[model samples]
Target: MSNDFYRLSILPHVAIVIKICRAYTNSQEDFEDYYQEVCLQIWRSKDNFKEQCEWSTWVYKISLNVCLTLLKKKKNNYQNFASDSLPEEAIVESHAFADESLNQLFDAIRQLSEVDRGVILLYLEEKSYQEIADIIGTNANNIGVRITRIKERLKKLLDGKIN
Candidate 1:
């Protein structure tokens, strides 16, 4: 992707993609792969964007779908269509963890099912339940219930009660 495209289409919503990528990948290399794939997919699907919602919300849906799809594909079997250059390659750390607790939180989050991981990541991003429901293909009430259950599951995982 070109610098200008990344700046306009992705930089504005990079956090949403980055967080979803982070929650789904087991290692830095996988995170980078997922990030690049998400960016490429975004650009590939640009014209398909119907503008039914905010650009950032469209970004969230694409990012989540790409992450989930990549996770389902075995590592060696996946073919990447991304370019060698990425905006992040020119700047920023591979992944930024603000604190140890944040790392612990992500670790716990990784233990959840893929769909649940997206739910909690969206929740942490402060997206409204309705927005999350839209992305997850469910209603707001189910999202609320899922969030409650996901939190409890995360707590157990963090407490070392589940693996």
Candidate 2:
């Protein structure tokens, strides 16, 4: 790895990898494993990253793919995963709500299909809809509509409005 690449490409995105891993894996141990896996995948794929898309978008695709694969493998093993053991740094940095409310929101997010949760997280991060669509391979116009439904669903979950 070139020093410039490390300095420029990889360093900036470490937090994103952690966030994605946390959202996908839930457990501390699993988060560590997934984080390492994402790093490894990014390192291996660096040579092939044709620069056709923004670096962050490319990284997001790789990270999400790795996370989904891990989720599928874990599902086959019947192991339970909960997003309760969030990293301390993440808890300190999060501005969404109090711990209890954030926990509730995380629980609600977990109830969403993986793709929906991805959209919600990106939305929360204030990513432009075009960037999010590129990361998730969805139409930009559809993102707004999907987000509307997702917000309604999440609100129902949060309010105990879902029977």
Pairs in steric clash, model 1: none
User: Which segments of candidate 1 are over 4 A away from where they belong?
Assistant: 72-98, 160-163
- 1-163 per-residue lDDT for model 1 (tens digits): 6888899989999988888988876567778889999999999998889989999999999999998777444434222222122222322222348676677777677667778888999999999999999998999999999999999877875686334
Residues 32-85, candidate 2: write the lDDT tens digits: 788888888888898889989878878888888787677534542232243333
- Cα miss at 31, model 2 (Å)? 1.3
> Cα deviation of 78 in candidate 2 (Å)?
5.0
Q: Spell out the clash pairs found in candidate 2.
A: none
The top-ranked prediction according to lDDT is: 1
The TM-score, computed over Cα atoms with residue i paired to residue i, of candidate 1 is 0.81
Best model number under TM-score: 1
Candidate 1, residue 64: how far the Cα is off, in Å: 0.4
